[model samples]
Target chain A: MKDDYKDKLDSLPVDIKLRAADRLKIHLMRQKYGYFSRLCLLMALIGPGILVMIADNDAGGVMTYAQTGSIFGIGFFIPFMIVMLPVAYIVQEMTVRLGAVTHRGHAEMIWKRYGKFWGAFSLIDLIIANVLTLITEFIGITIGMRVFGVPPLISSISAVLIIASIQLFLRYFAWEWISLSIAAFNLVFVPLVFFVPHLHWGAVARSFGTWHIKGGVSSLFIYVVLANLGTTIAPWMLFFQQSSVVDKGLTVKDIRDGQFDTFIGSVFMVIVAIAIILITAGTVYGLTQTPNLDIQTILSAISSKMGPLAMRLFALGLVEAGLIAAIAISASTSWAMGEAFGWPKSINMPPIEGWKFYLPGVISLLIAGGIVLIPNAPLGFLNLTVQVVATIFMPAAMMFLLLLLNDKEIMGEHINKHWQNISAFTIVGFLIIMNFMYGLTVVFPHILG
Target chain B: MIKYIDIIGFNGKRCDMKNNKKTSKDINLDEDWEDFIKEEGLIDYNKIPVQKAEIKGWVQIAFWFLRIYILVMIIMVIIGFSRIK
Candidate 1:
């Protein structure tokens, strides 16, 4: 039987062969019937979901949460973060099902199932948003490394090399496992929350009921709300997860495991988000109520209140968040380009074999990494642009996802149930309203004043 | 018709067969071929061109909504950036 499997695998194309070998393990695991066996099967099947969710909490997300805590404290955003878990899961779960059913990435589906115009639109938007987001990630990386006396040039170049190498050298399974290993560092913020001086668990618990915005519904509050929402469900996440599911070779059989993985990842993402909120809320909230507080100010506040060790841990978490997100974002870029152009796309493909597949991702990484090192670069403007681009692109991406998920021909039996559609659409509707409000604030600046 | 043979070997490299003899074994007569394909979820999706979906019902509405939403947002952004300038 082993020899037969080997011979069969040997006959597959290079890219598919690696995926086949991984799926073959899953097939064998499925034949067994036991509690432990089921657990093992789930462990084998879980990657894309957890990776996507955790990677969603990228460096920008870290800064967003920290600033939320600094500006508003845990009064409202903590409970708000709790609401986001389900939002993240509902939006992301559709990708798992869509990928499993269609075996296509989001870009390919939009391109083929819609038309070139929409496809190009989505592709261009995704690529632009991804590049801009990558710059923020690199900014986070360089800034965090500065806490440890590393120069921006060294940190930025090293980050690009590390991310590019991970994408270039590792196959899908190793890539995911390695990325998950790095993602585990995102939880470093959770443990540091306990070290925050004068953090009141009682006040944190009371936040669920109070849900109070410190300054009322001001422009800053709306901006923060939209920023949190943007971080929770960006357009890249949709493309990332679907492409990840397709690349990981998950089928409908693995959907249950994928959902569980996504749920677990969401739980962690929210937990870490709340932890950052708490850490800063406890340490930096009263110290600084400035809406435009930079991460350096927040970190200095943390260091002042929580001691150097805790602040260092927060910085380490920032670096890890940036690194892991860079990996996922770059891979999503590569995958989307490959899917749209009909190029052979898989991380399992060898470097020489998938050069075309890897080029776009590497180029995006280089552009972002290089941009961050330039002196006097308008990173603030770029960050705002990332938000604006995501704001515009997110609804369009969600509509495509909802459309693809509802489509009967491709989705077949896996087409979204009625409840799923209601939940997804409601989420999309809520996102659009918030985005519109955010846009209004951007334009008027005094609309909420 | 020109016959082309594409063989994937154990090293996971593909070989083009212009002058190579076509062999019956290359057809994958093994019973596990079906199982392998099924288990691997190996559909050559690129070969299957997906038709542009018929946009009549709610999908059309969603697209129209998206168009308006994008237009409005772009205008707002333009105004916002102009204010900044």
Candidate 2:
């Protein structure tokens, strides 16, 4: 029977085979160790959630958190970030159910259910946001490398090669494992929090009580808030996690384990975000005279304030952030495209079988890397544009997610509860309002006035 | 173009039928339509039945609102980018 099953699996397509292998592992684990299968199940189901959340704390995300601390201090944003934990988990948890129940990625579901118009809308938004976001990752990589005396050309080339190889060589489970290993380094920011001079537990504690904005309700404050929101829940995250859950072969039976995975990821994500905020808030906040410092300048501030070791550690964090995000985002682009066009896509496939699947992601990375290496690219503007585009498209993504989650046909018994829909729609409503405010400020600089 | 409903003698069927009483080998066909007809019990093809989607009235309203919302966002993004010299 086992041999026959293996033969059947061997005849299946590469994508299906990968999912079957994952399902088989979970099945075997449950069959073998009935009592302690919970641990085994979590171990197998841990990748997609942790990868998505930590990758959410990407280079751009880390920079935003750092800038948050440097600009506003940790008073308001730390508590705000802690609040984002449930927000992120609740939002991502729906994707788990959607993927498991439907056995389809977000793009496929959108296209198949909502017709071509919304499908094309999501695809275009995702592709543009993904490419622009990849440029930021490369920017993070090159900038972080420059701190270590590596030139941009060498850094970009090495990064592109490493990212491509991560996608091309490893299968789904191995790819997730390797990506998680890299993502673990994002924790370097956590310990660096302890290096803060005269770091006060009281201030961090008092901020939750106060929940006060330092500069009051200003345009820069709104910009930073929108940027944090952009980094927290973007369209790519929705696509990426749903596709990953599908790829990992999670079913309705595995939804509990999936939620557990996302919960763990949310905890890790918020902790790391808070740590980056602390690191910057400790070393750079009031000590520096400049109110508006770029990420590089912020790194230099950390170096001068906390010494060389801390500086290098922070830079290492940046590299890891960029590298892991590149891996996940590249895979996300591949998965989204494949699902949209109904092409074969899986990290499990060999180069020959899945070259069509891998081409778009690798080419995107290459283009982003090339853009980063250009002599006089306006990286700051590019970064802002990425954040802006992501912010703008966020409502559409959230709306689709809400619609899909509330759909009785697709979700059935696993549909969103009353509280889930309320919370999800509330978040969507907040995003629409924030996008409107951000747009007004962009169009009319004196709108706030 | 023999309808599965004609063969099974059950017209006006929606996606409610979920019984997998027959396997693919029983039909001796590997075509996608055969799999769909058997797997989904989609015997009725005369009326344009809603396959797996259930977009009712309020849902339709929400969907169109989102469409307009997304369009406005795209415009805002264009304006935002154009200002980014």
Candidate 3:
């Protein structure tokens, strides 16, 4: 049987062969009956959900959380982030089922099912938002590295090379494991919370009751809320996770494990988000009420309040956030392009064999990395544009996801339950309302005020 | 027997294999192939064309909603960016 299996594998194409090799291990693991075997099988099945959730706390997300903490303190956002766990989980879990049931990425599903116009619209929006978001990742990378005496040019170039090489060289399994390993470093902020000089546990616990809005509700408050929402669930996450699951070869049998993976990831994402909020709220809140609260300001506040080591650890976490997100985002770009264009798409493909699939991602990285190194680029404007694009595109993405999930022909038995539709619609409704309010705030700068 | 599979290669070019051959080892009539395909979730998705969905009932309403939503958002963005300076 072993010889026969090897013979069968040898007869397959290279990309499929690599994926089959990994899936073959999973197949064998499934045949065994024990607690240990079940644990092993779960370990094998859990990657896409966790990776997507952690990558959700991208470089831009880190800055947003830090800014939220500094501006609003821990009162509102702590409990708010706790609520986001379910929001993040509910939104991401659908992707797992979509991928597992159809063996197709989100882009491919949209392209084929919805016809060309909506397909082009989605692909263009995704690619633009992804490139802009990648710029923020590069910004985080360069800024964080500058703390350790590295220049922007070297850091940006090196980051591009590293991310591109990882995508080009590694198979899907190795790529996922390496990316998750980097994601683990995002926990650096969690422990640094303990070192905060005057972090009051009572205040943290009491936040659930108050959900306090500092200085009443204003435009700044709405902007911060929307920013946090944007970070928690972005359009990239939908495309990325579905593509990741498809690439990792998840099936209906693994859907439960995939959901569990997403749940665990959601917990981690919220914990890290709250940790950053707590760290900044403890240190920077009430110290500076500056409207333009950049990360350098936050880092300095951490240095003065919590010593240089904690500050440095925070910087390290920032770098990891940027790096992990770049890997995930760029790969999503590549995956989406391949899916839309009917190209062979898999991280398992060898570099030479998969150059077409790898080009879009690498080009995006170069554009972002190069832009960050240019002196006096409008980075703040770019960041705001990222928010605006995500705001506009998110609901559309969700609508498509909901449409696909509810489709009887594609999903069959794995169709979304009644509760799932209600929950998703409620999320969409909330997002549209918030986006409308956000737009109003933009049009009328003092509307909320 | 010679078999050929046309694959889309680099740059959207179609490359055809000339001397592809299948032997007994390649033909897995056993349960292993089915198990492998099932576990791997390997579907030739490119080969199976998904039909254009009939956008009616609630789906049409959703599409209309999306169109209005996007148009409104784009106008707001234009206004917002116009006032950026």
For lDDT, the strongest prediction is 3
Query: Judged by DockQ relative to the true structure, which candidate is superior, 1 or 2?
Result: 1
User: Which order, best to worst by lDDT?
Assistant: 3, 1, 2
Residues A1-449, candidate 2: write the lDDT tens digits: 34544554566555565555455445444433233344545787778999999999998998888888998887889999998999899899999999888777898888878887888888987988899999999988988888899998999999999989878877777688999999999999998888888789899999999998986877777888888888889899999999998777777777898899999999999999999999999888976534357887888889888888999999989989999998888889998888888777567767667888899899999999999989888887777768766876778888888888988876899999999999998898888888888777877877776
Consecutive 10-residue window with the lowest summed lDDT within model 3 chain A:
A28-37
lDDT digits (tens) for residues A35-113 of candidate 3: 6556767888898888999999998999999999998897988999999999999999999999999999999999999
lDDT-better candidate, 2 vs 3? 3
Considering only N, C-alpha and C atoms within 3 Å, which residue pairs clash in candidate 3?
none
TM-score of chain A by itself in each prediction: 0.99, 0.97, 0.99
Model 2, residue pairs in steric clash: none
Clashes found in each candidate (C-alpha, N, C closer than 3 A) = 0, 0, 0
Which model is ahead, 2 or 3, in terms of DockQ? 3
Candidate 1's TM-score = 0.94
At residue A392, candidate 3 shows an lDDT of: 92
Cα displacement (Å) at residue B71, model 1: 0.7
